[model samples]
Target: MLFSFEFSPIAVATLTFLLAGFVKGVIGLGLPTVAMGLLSTVMAPAQAASLLIVPSFVTNVWQLATGPRFGALARRLWPMMAGVVVGTLAGTGFMQGSHAGQAAIALGVALMAYAVLGLTAMRFAVPPRAERWLGPVIGAVTGLMTAATGVFVIPAVPYLGALGLPKDELIQALGLSFTVSTVALAAALAGGGSFETGTAGASALALAPALIGMSVGGWMRGRVSERMFRRCFFLGLLALGAHLASRALI
Candidate 1:
Protein backbone atom coordinates (compact mmCIF):
# COMPACT_ATOMS: atom_id res chain seq x y z
CA MET A 1 0.00 0.00 0.00
CA LEU A 2 1.25 3.47 -0.77
CA PHE A 3 1.73 5.77 2.18
CA SER A 4 -0.66 8.58 1.48
CA PHE A 5 -1.52 11.65 3.44
CA GLU A 6 -3.03 14.65 1.62
CA PHE A 7 -0.22 14.17 -0.92
CA SER A 8 1.66 11.20 -2.28
CA PRO A 9 4.29 10.06 0.18
CA ILE A 10 6.91 9.86 -2.55
CA ALA A 11 6.29 13.43 -3.64
CA VAL A 12 6.36 14.60 -0.07
CA ALA A 13 9.57 12.74 0.65
CA THR A 14 11.28 13.98 -2.49
CA LEU A 15 10.35 17.62 -1.99
CA THR A 16 11.15 17.47 1.70
CA PHE A 17 14.56 16.01 1.02
CA LEU A 18 15.26 18.50 -1.71
CA LEU A 19 14.48 21.39 0.58
CA ALA A 20 16.12 19.83 3.63
CA GLY A 21 19.18 18.96 1.61
CA PHE A 22 19.36 22.47 0.28
CA VAL A 23 19.28 23.81 3.79
CA LYS A 24 22.04 21.48 4.91
CA GLY A 25 24.09 22.31 1.88
CA VAL A 26 23.78 25.99 2.68
CA ILE A 27 24.42 25.38 6.35
CA GLY A 28 26.61 22.68 7.80
CA LEU A 29 23.80 20.95 9.68
CA GLY A 30 19.97 20.52 9.70
CA LEU A 31 19.21 17.74 7.20
CA PRO A 32 17.70 15.51 9.87
CA THR A 33 16.34 18.41 11.79
CA VAL A 34 14.60 19.88 8.78
CA ALA A 35 13.47 16.53 7.49
CA MET A 36 12.04 15.44 10.81
CA GLY A 37 10.24 18.72 11.34
CA LEU A 38 8.55 18.54 7.95
CA LEU A 39 7.96 14.81 7.60
CA SER A 40 6.45 14.46 11.05
CA THR A 41 3.55 16.66 9.98
CA VAL A 42 2.34 14.07 7.48
CA MET A 43 3.40 10.88 9.28
CA ALA A 44 4.15 9.70 12.76
CA PRO A 45 7.49 10.78 14.18
CA ALA A 46 8.63 7.15 14.35
CA GLN A 47 7.84 6.68 10.70
CA ALA A 48 9.54 9.96 9.84
CA ALA A 49 12.56 8.76 11.77
CA SER A 50 12.77 5.55 9.77
CA LEU A 51 12.68 7.44 6.50
CA LEU A 52 15.39 9.85 7.62
CA ILE A 53 17.92 7.27 8.76
CA VAL A 54 19.80 6.60 5.55
CA PRO A 55 20.03 10.19 4.40
CA SER A 56 20.99 11.44 7.82
CA PHE A 57 23.60 8.77 8.35
CA VAL A 58 25.21 9.13 4.95
CA THR A 59 25.31 12.91 5.10
CA ASN A 60 26.65 12.94 8.62
CA VAL A 61 29.39 10.46 7.73
CA TRP A 62 30.42 12.66 4.84
CA GLN A 63 30.44 15.64 7.17
CA LEU A 64 32.37 13.70 9.82
CA ALA A 65 35.14 12.77 7.38
CA THR A 66 35.47 16.12 5.71
CA GLY A 67 37.66 17.97 8.19
CA PRO A 68 40.86 17.20 10.09
CA ARG A 69 41.74 15.58 13.46
CA PHE A 70 39.19 12.81 13.02
CA GLY A 71 41.01 10.46 15.37
CA ALA A 72 41.39 13.02 18.10
CA LEU A 73 37.78 14.07 17.82
CA ALA A 74 36.54 10.50 18.03
CA ARG A 75 38.68 9.76 21.05
CA ARG A 76 37.53 12.88 22.78
CA LEU A 77 33.88 12.20 22.10
CA TRP A 78 33.61 8.44 22.75
CA PRO A 79 32.18 8.79 26.23
CA MET A 80 29.42 11.05 25.01
CA MET A 81 28.75 8.71 22.10
CA ALA A 82 28.44 5.79 24.48
CA GLY A 83 26.15 7.80 26.66
CA VAL A 84 23.97 8.65 23.69
CA VAL A 85 23.61 4.98 22.82
CA VAL A 86 22.73 4.02 26.36
CA GLY A 87 20.20 6.79 26.83
CA THR A 88 18.58 6.15 23.49
CA LEU A 89 18.17 2.45 24.21
CA ALA A 90 16.82 3.20 27.63
CA GLY A 91 14.28 5.64 26.29
CA THR A 92 13.28 3.73 23.20
CA GLY A 93 10.23 2.24 24.91
CA PHE A 94 8.59 5.64 24.98
CA MET A 95 8.77 6.09 21.20
CA GLN A 96 6.96 2.97 20.06
CA GLY A 97 3.35 1.84 19.78
CA SER A 98 0.73 3.94 21.56
CA HIS A 99 3.30 6.45 22.79
CA ALA A 100 3.95 7.96 19.38
CA GLY A 101 1.75 11.00 19.95
CA GLN A 102 3.70 11.83 23.06
CA ALA A 103 6.86 11.51 21.06
CA ALA A 104 5.47 13.99 18.52
CA ILE A 105 4.78 16.44 21.29
CA ALA A 106 8.29 16.02 22.56
CA LEU A 107 9.66 16.64 19.10
CA GLY A 108 7.65 19.81 18.87
CA VAL A 109 8.89 21.13 22.16
CA ALA A 110 12.46 20.35 21.21
CA LEU A 111 12.13 22.16 17.92
CA MET A 112 10.68 25.21 19.61
CA ALA A 113 13.48 25.29 22.11
CA TYR A 114 16.10 24.91 19.41
CA ALA A 115 14.53 27.68 17.39
CA VAL A 116 14.41 30.06 20.31
CA LEU A 117 18.03 29.39 21.10
CA GLY A 118 19.12 29.92 17.52
CA LEU A 119 17.07 33.04 17.18
CA THR A 120 18.51 34.45 20.33
CA ALA A 121 22.03 33.62 19.26
CA MET A 122 22.85 32.75 22.81
CA ARG A 123 26.37 31.51 23.45
CA PHE A 124 27.80 29.68 26.43
CA ALA A 125 31.30 28.95 27.50
CA VAL A 126 32.10 25.55 28.97
CA PRO A 127 35.44 25.40 30.69
CA PRO A 128 37.75 22.72 29.35
CA ARG A 129 37.95 21.19 32.82
CA ALA A 130 34.20 20.71 32.88
CA GLU A 131 33.97 18.68 29.71
CA ARG A 132 35.08 15.34 31.13
CA TRP A 133 32.00 15.02 33.31
CA LEU A 134 29.65 17.17 31.29
CA GLY A 135 30.01 15.53 27.92
CA PRO A 136 28.51 12.21 28.91
CA VAL A 137 25.70 13.82 30.82
CA ILE A 138 24.89 16.03 27.89
CA GLY A 139 25.06 13.05 25.62
CA ALA A 140 22.67 11.09 27.76
CA VAL A 141 20.20 13.92 27.84
CA THR A 142 20.51 14.40 24.11
CA GLY A 143 19.96 10.71 23.56
CA LEU A 144 16.82 10.79 25.62
CA MET A 145 15.67 13.73 23.59
CA THR A 146 16.39 11.78 20.41
CA ALA A 147 14.41 8.78 21.64
CA ALA A 148 11.46 10.96 22.50
CA THR A 149 11.67 12.90 19.30
CA GLY A 150 13.21 11.97 15.98
CA VAL A 151 15.38 15.07 16.38
CA PHE A 152 18.72 15.16 18.25
CA VAL A 153 19.91 18.76 18.35
CA ILE A 154 18.74 19.97 21.69
CA PRO A 155 21.21 20.49 24.50
CA ALA A 156 23.77 18.53 22.52
CA VAL A 157 24.08 21.12 19.80
CA PRO A 158 24.12 23.95 22.30
CA TYR A 159 26.63 22.16 24.52
CA LEU A 160 28.92 21.44 21.62
CA GLY A 161 28.60 25.01 20.50
CA ALA A 162 29.68 26.08 23.97
CA LEU A 163 32.89 24.08 23.80
CA GLY A 164 34.61 26.84 21.88
CA LEU A 165 36.27 24.62 19.36
CA PRO A 166 37.64 26.20 16.20
CA LYS A 167 35.32 26.42 13.21
CA ASP A 168 36.42 23.23 11.49
CA GLU A 169 36.61 21.29 14.72
CA LEU A 170 33.13 22.39 15.80
CA ILE A 171 31.57 21.27 12.53
CA GLN A 172 33.40 17.96 12.77
CA ALA A 173 32.22 17.50 16.32
CA LEU A 174 28.60 18.05 15.22
CA GLY A 175 29.04 15.47 12.50
CA LEU A 176 30.48 13.02 14.98
CA SER A 177 27.68 13.54 17.46
CA PHE A 178 24.95 13.39 14.82
CA THR A 179 26.49 10.27 13.30
CA VAL A 180 26.38 8.50 16.64
CA SER A 181 22.86 9.69 17.28
CA THR A 182 21.78 8.36 13.88
CA VAL A 183 23.31 4.95 14.51
CA ALA A 184 21.83 4.76 17.96
CA LEU A 185 18.39 5.83 16.77
CA ALA A 186 18.53 3.23 14.03
CA ALA A 187 19.47 0.54 16.51
CA ALA A 188 16.67 1.51 18.88
CA LEU A 189 14.16 1.46 16.03
CA ALA A 190 15.31 -1.93 14.83
CA GLY A 191 15.16 -3.31 18.35
CA GLY A 192 11.59 -2.05 18.69
CA GLY A 193 10.64 -3.47 15.26
CA SER A 194 10.04 -0.06 13.67
CA PHE A 195 12.93 -0.16 11.25
CA GLU A 196 12.39 -3.11 8.95
CA THR A 197 13.37 -3.83 5.36
CA GLY A 198 10.61 -1.68 3.90
CA THR A 199 11.50 1.34 5.98
CA ALA A 200 15.17 0.87 5.17
CA GLY A 201 14.37 0.83 1.48
CA ALA A 202 12.35 4.03 1.77
CA SER A 203 15.18 5.66 3.69
CA ALA A 204 17.64 4.59 1.02
CA LEU A 205 15.47 6.05 -1.71
CA ALA A 206 15.33 9.41 0.09
CA LEU A 207 19.10 9.66 -0.08
CA ALA A 208 19.36 10.70 -3.70
CA PRO A 209 17.32 13.90 -3.51
CA ALA A 210 19.09 14.72 -0.31
CA LEU A 211 22.43 14.50 -2.05
CA ILE A 212 21.17 16.55 -4.94
CA GLY A 213 19.86 19.22 -2.60
CA MET A 214 23.14 19.25 -0.77
CA SER A 215 25.01 19.80 -3.98
CA VAL A 216 22.84 22.78 -4.85
CA GLY A 217 23.12 24.15 -1.34
CA GLY A 218 26.87 23.81 -1.40
CA TRP A 219 26.98 25.69 -4.64
CA MET A 220 24.75 28.40 -3.20
CA ARG A 221 26.88 28.78 -0.09
CA GLY A 222 29.11 31.43 -1.61
CA ARG A 223 26.15 33.34 -2.92
CA VAL A 224 23.91 33.19 0.14
CA SER A 225 24.36 35.05 3.38
CA GLU A 226 24.54 32.39 6.06
CA ARG A 227 23.19 34.62 8.77
CA MET A 228 20.11 35.37 6.72
CA PHE A 229 19.55 31.75 5.82
CA ARG A 230 19.91 30.60 9.42
CA ARG A 231 17.37 33.13 10.55
CA CYS A 232 14.89 31.90 7.99
CA PHE A 233 15.55 28.30 8.91
CA PHE A 234 14.87 28.90 12.57
CA LEU A 235 11.71 30.74 11.74
CA GLY A 236 10.51 27.84 9.66
CA LEU A 237 11.29 25.47 12.49
CA LEU A 238 9.41 27.64 14.95
CA ALA A 239 6.28 27.60 12.83
CA LEU A 240 6.57 23.92 12.10
CA GLY A 241 7.05 23.12 15.76
CA ALA A 242 3.97 25.08 16.71
CA HIS A 243 1.90 23.30 14.13
CA LEU A 244 3.08 19.86 15.18
CA ALA A 245 2.50 20.52 18.85
CA SER A 246 -0.97 21.89 18.30
CA ARG A 247 -1.88 19.16 15.88
CA ALA A 248 -0.81 16.49 18.30
CA LEU A 249 -2.87 18.06 21.05
CA ILE A 250 -5.99 18.27 18.92
Candidate 2:
Protein backbone atom coordinates (compact mmCIF):
# COMPACT_ATOMS: atom_id res chain seq x y z
CA MET A 1 0.00 0.00 0.00
CA LEU A 2 1.16 3.53 -0.70
CA PHE A 3 0.16 4.68 2.73
CA SER A 4 -2.48 4.59 5.41
CA PHE A 5 -4.77 7.56 6.21
CA GLU A 6 -2.86 7.93 9.42
CA PHE A 7 0.14 9.22 7.49
CA SER A 8 0.01 12.91 6.65
CA PRO A 9 2.41 12.57 3.73
CA ILE A 10 0.13 10.20 1.90
CA ALA A 11 -2.88 12.41 2.45
CA VAL A 12 -0.99 15.51 1.32
CA ALA A 13 0.40 13.78 -1.75
CA THR A 14 -2.97 12.37 -2.70
CA LEU A 15 -4.72 15.71 -2.34
CA THR A 16 -2.01 17.49 -4.27
CA PHE A 17 -2.32 15.03 -7.14
CA LEU A 18 -6.09 15.31 -7.14
CA LEU A 19 -6.01 19.09 -7.16
CA ALA A 20 -3.42 19.17 -9.92
CA GLY A 21 -5.43 16.79 -12.04
CA PHE A 22 -8.57 18.80 -11.56
CA VAL A 23 -6.86 21.94 -12.76
CA LYS A 24 -5.55 20.12 -15.81
CA GLY A 25 -8.99 18.78 -16.61
CA VAL A 26 -10.53 22.23 -16.50
CA ILE A 27 -7.81 24.34 -18.06
CA GLY A 28 -6.03 21.74 -20.21
CA LEU A 29 -2.72 22.35 -18.39
CA GLY A 30 -1.08 23.29 -15.07
CA LEU A 31 -0.86 19.82 -13.54
CA PRO A 32 2.86 20.15 -12.98
CA THR A 33 2.48 23.70 -11.77
CA VAL A 34 -0.09 22.74 -9.19
CA ALA A 35 1.55 19.48 -8.16
CA MET A 36 5.04 20.89 -7.83
CA GLY A 37 3.96 24.02 -6.03
CA LEU A 38 1.74 22.26 -3.53
CA LEU A 39 4.04 19.32 -2.93
CA SER A 40 7.07 21.49 -2.43
CA THR A 41 5.41 22.86 0.67
CA VAL A 42 5.45 19.41 2.27
CA MET A 43 8.62 17.70 1.02
CA ALA A 44 12.00 18.18 -0.49
CA PRO A 45 11.79 19.68 -3.96
CA ALA A 46 13.39 16.71 -5.71
CA GLN A 47 11.27 14.18 -3.86
CA ALA A 48 8.17 16.15 -4.70
CA ALA A 49 9.21 16.25 -8.31
CA SER A 50 9.87 12.54 -8.35
CA LEU A 51 6.33 11.96 -7.13
CA LEU A 52 4.96 13.85 -10.13
CA ILE A 53 6.61 11.66 -12.78
CA VAL A 54 4.13 8.83 -13.23
CA PRO A 55 0.97 10.89 -12.96
CA SER A 56 2.14 13.62 -15.30
CA PHE A 57 3.41 11.09 -17.80
CA VAL A 58 0.19 9.11 -17.74
CA THR A 59 -2.07 12.14 -18.03
CA ASN A 60 -0.12 13.77 -20.82
CA VAL A 61 0.03 10.51 -22.73
CA TRP A 62 -3.74 10.28 -22.43
CA GLN A 63 -4.04 13.83 -23.69
CA LEU A 64 -1.77 13.13 -26.64
CA ALA A 65 -3.57 9.96 -27.63
CA THR A 66 -6.94 11.67 -27.53
CA GLY A 67 -5.71 14.45 -29.75
CA PRO A 68 -6.12 14.55 -33.55
CA ARG A 69 -2.52 13.67 -34.49
CA PHE A 70 1.02 13.52 -33.19
CA GLY A 71 4.41 12.74 -34.89
CA ALA A 72 4.49 16.10 -36.65
CA LEU A 73 4.16 18.01 -33.42
CA ALA A 74 6.78 15.89 -31.74
CA ARG A 75 9.13 16.48 -34.66
CA ARG A 76 8.51 20.19 -34.62
CA LEU A 77 9.22 20.33 -30.93
CA TRP A 78 12.38 18.20 -31.05
CA PRO A 79 14.61 21.09 -30.21
CA MET A 80 12.64 21.72 -27.09
CA MET A 81 13.00 18.07 -26.21
CA ALA A 82 16.75 18.13 -26.61
CA GLY A 83 16.96 21.31 -24.61
CA VAL A 84 14.86 19.86 -21.83
CA VAL A 85 17.20 16.89 -21.46
CA VAL A 86 20.34 18.96 -21.42
CA GLY A 87 19.00 21.63 -19.14
CA THR A 88 17.54 19.20 -16.67
CA LEU A 89 20.77 17.22 -16.43
CA ALA A 90 22.82 20.37 -15.97
CA GLY A 91 20.46 21.81 -13.39
CA THR A 92 20.43 18.62 -11.34
CA GLY A 93 24.09 19.12 -10.60
CA PHE A 94 23.18 22.08 -8.46
CA MET A 95 20.85 20.34 -6.07
CA GLN A 96 22.92 21.64 -3.19
CA GLY A 97 24.65 24.55 -4.80
CA SER A 98 25.20 27.69 -2.79
CA HIS A 99 22.53 29.33 -4.94
CA ALA A 100 19.89 26.75 -4.17
CA GLY A 101 17.73 29.23 -2.30
CA GLN A 102 18.12 31.68 -5.13
CA ALA A 103 17.03 28.98 -7.54
CA ALA A 104 13.90 28.43 -5.47
CA ILE A 105 13.20 32.14 -5.48
CA ALA A 106 13.57 32.10 -9.24
CA LEU A 107 10.92 29.39 -9.37
CA GLY A 108 8.49 31.58 -7.42
CA VAL A 109 9.27 34.47 -9.73
CA ALA A 110 8.69 32.23 -12.74
CA LEU A 111 5.29 31.16 -11.43
CA MET A 112 4.19 34.71 -10.70
CA ALA A 113 5.36 35.78 -14.11
CA TYR A 114 3.36 33.04 -15.76
CA ALA A 115 0.31 34.00 -13.73
CA VAL A 116 0.66 37.65 -14.76
CA LEU A 117 1.04 36.68 -18.39
CA GLY A 118 -2.11 34.61 -18.18
CA LEU A 119 -4.03 37.49 -16.61
CA THR A 120 -3.03 39.95 -19.32
CA ALA A 121 -4.20 40.15 -22.91
CA MET A 122 -0.78 39.76 -24.45
CA ARG A 123 0.56 37.18 -26.84
CA PHE A 124 3.89 36.93 -28.63
CA ALA A 125 4.43 35.89 -32.18
CA VAL A 126 7.67 34.17 -33.05
CA PRO A 127 7.77 34.24 -36.76
CA PRO A 128 8.84 30.83 -38.11
CA ARG A 129 12.22 32.32 -38.87
CA ALA A 130 12.72 33.13 -35.24
CA GLU A 131 11.19 29.94 -33.85
CA ARG A 132 14.11 27.91 -35.15
CA TRP A 133 16.30 29.75 -32.67
CA LEU A 134 13.84 30.39 -29.89
CA GLY A 135 12.26 26.97 -29.44
CA PRO A 136 15.31 25.21 -28.00
CA VAL A 137 16.25 28.22 -25.92
CA ILE A 138 12.83 28.30 -24.30
CA GLY A 139 12.89 24.56 -23.81
CA ALA A 140 16.26 24.58 -22.09
CA VAL A 141 15.18 27.28 -19.67
CA THR A 142 11.96 25.43 -18.97
CA GLY A 143 13.98 22.34 -18.17
CA LEU A 144 16.17 24.34 -15.87
CA MET A 145 13.11 25.69 -14.12
CA THR A 146 11.65 22.22 -13.87
CA ALA A 147 14.79 20.84 -12.32
CA ALA A 148 15.02 23.65 -9.85
CA THR A 149 11.37 23.94 -8.81
CA GLY A 150 9.45 21.16 -10.57
CA VAL A 151 7.48 23.70 -12.60
CA PHE A 152 7.66 23.63 -16.42
CA VAL A 153 5.06 25.96 -17.90
CA ILE A 154 6.70 29.29 -18.18
CA PRO A 155 8.28 30.08 -21.53
CA ALA A 156 7.25 26.74 -23.00
CA VAL A 157 3.48 27.29 -22.80
CA PRO A 158 3.71 30.95 -23.69
CA TYR A 159 6.02 30.11 -26.53
CA LEU A 160 3.65 27.45 -27.76
CA GLY A 161 0.79 29.92 -27.51
CA ALA A 162 2.64 32.31 -29.78
CA LEU A 163 2.65 29.75 -32.58
CA GLY A 164 -0.93 30.68 -33.44
CA LEU A 165 -2.17 27.22 -34.27
CA PRO A 166 -5.73 25.98 -34.26
CA LYS A 167 -7.09 25.15 -30.83
CA ASP A 168 -6.72 21.40 -31.21
CA GLU A 169 -3.24 21.67 -32.58
CA LEU A 170 -2.15 23.85 -29.71
CA ILE A 171 -3.51 21.39 -27.22
CA GLN A 172 -1.73 18.54 -28.96
CA ALA A 173 1.52 20.43 -28.96
CA LEU A 174 1.19 21.10 -25.26
CA GLY A 175 0.68 17.44 -24.59
CA LEU A 176 3.83 16.61 -26.47
CA SER A 177 5.77 19.33 -24.73
CA PHE A 178 4.59 18.31 -21.30
CA THR A 179 5.26 14.65 -21.99
CA VAL A 180 8.79 15.49 -23.00
CA SER A 181 9.24 17.61 -19.91
CA THR A 182 7.99 14.85 -17.65
CA VAL A 183 10.30 12.29 -19.20
CA ALA A 184 13.26 14.61 -18.94
CA LEU A 185 12.45 15.20 -15.29
CA ALA A 186 12.24 11.51 -14.60
CA ALA A 187 15.53 10.98 -16.30
CA ALA A 188 17.15 13.72 -14.27
CA LEU A 189 15.86 12.25 -11.04
CA ALA A 190 17.09 8.82 -12.01
CA GLY A 191 20.45 10.23 -12.97
CA GLY A 192 20.71 11.97 -9.63
CA GLY A 193 19.75 8.78 -7.79
CA SER A 194 16.76 10.51 -6.27
CA PHE A 195 14.18 8.28 -7.93
CA GLU A 196 13.76 4.54 -7.39
CA THR A 197 11.34 1.75 -8.08
CA GLY A 198 9.66 2.36 -4.75
CA THR A 199 9.08 6.02 -5.55
CA ALA A 200 7.79 5.04 -8.98
CA GLY A 201 5.36 2.62 -7.37
CA ALA A 202 3.96 5.28 -5.10
CA SER A 203 3.61 7.65 -8.01
CA ALA A 204 1.80 5.03 -10.04
CA LEU A 205 -0.65 4.43 -7.22
CA ALA A 206 -1.33 8.15 -7.00
CA LEU A 207 -2.62 8.06 -10.56
CA ALA A 208 -6.00 6.77 -9.43
CA PRO A 209 -6.83 9.96 -7.57
CA ALA A 210 -5.36 12.09 -10.33
CA LEU A 211 -7.46 10.48 -13.03
CA ILE A 212 -10.59 10.59 -10.92
CA GLY A 213 -10.09 14.26 -10.17
CA MET A 214 -9.53 14.94 -13.84
CA SER A 215 -12.84 13.29 -14.70
CA VAL A 216 -14.64 15.41 -12.17
CA GLY A 217 -12.97 18.53 -13.42
CA GLY A 218 -13.80 17.58 -16.99
CA TRP A 219 -17.47 17.27 -15.99
CA MET A 220 -17.36 20.55 -14.13
CA ARG A 221 -15.71 22.34 -17.04
CA GLY A 222 -18.86 22.20 -19.09
CA ARG A 223 -20.90 23.61 -16.24
CA VAL A 224 -18.45 26.31 -15.18
CA SER A 225 -17.18 29.53 -16.69
CA GLU A 226 -13.78 28.83 -18.22
CA ARG A 227 -12.75 32.47 -18.28
CA MET A 228 -13.57 32.90 -14.62
CA PHE A 229 -11.92 29.60 -13.79
CA ARG A 230 -8.76 30.74 -15.56
CA ARG A 231 -8.66 34.00 -13.69
CA CYS A 232 -9.09 32.20 -10.39
CA PHE A 233 -6.40 29.72 -11.34
CA PHE A 234 -3.89 32.44 -12.06
CA LEU A 235 -4.80 34.21 -8.86
CA GLY A 236 -4.32 31.03 -6.87
CA LEU A 237 -0.99 30.45 -8.56
CA LEU A 238 0.08 33.96 -7.65
CA ALA A 239 -0.70 33.31 -4.00
CA LEU A 240 1.15 30.01 -4.08
CA GLY A 241 4.13 31.63 -5.72
CA ALA A 242 4.19 34.28 -3.04
CA HIS A 243 4.19 31.65 -0.35
CA LEU A 244 6.99 29.67 -1.96
CA ALA A 245 9.06 32.76 -2.55
CA SER A 246 8.58 33.92 1.00
CA ARG A 247 9.48 30.53 2.37
CA ALA A 248 12.62 30.31 0.31
CA LEU A 249 13.77 33.87 0.83
CA ILE A 250 12.86 34.23 4.46
Pick the lDDT winner: 1
Off by over 4 Å in 2: 1-6, 95-100
How does residue 33 of candidate 2 score in lDDT? 89
Give me the displacement of residue 8 in model 1, in angstroms.
Answer: 1.9
TM per model? 0.97, 0.93
| Model 2 residue 247 CA deviation in Å | 1.1
Question: Global lDDT of each model?
Answer: 0.89, 0.83
Distance from true location, Cα of 22 in model 2, Å: 0.6
For residues 1-250, what per-residue lDDT tens digits would candidate 2 score against the true structure?
3222347888898999899899999989998888878877776677777789999999999888887868778778888878877888778844334655765677678788888998994788889888778888998998888788777887789999998878998898999888888898888888877677888988898899899889989989999999999999999989988988899988
RMSD after Cα superposition, model 2? 2.3
Error of 1 at 188 (Å): 0.3
| lDDT of model 1 at position 183 | 95
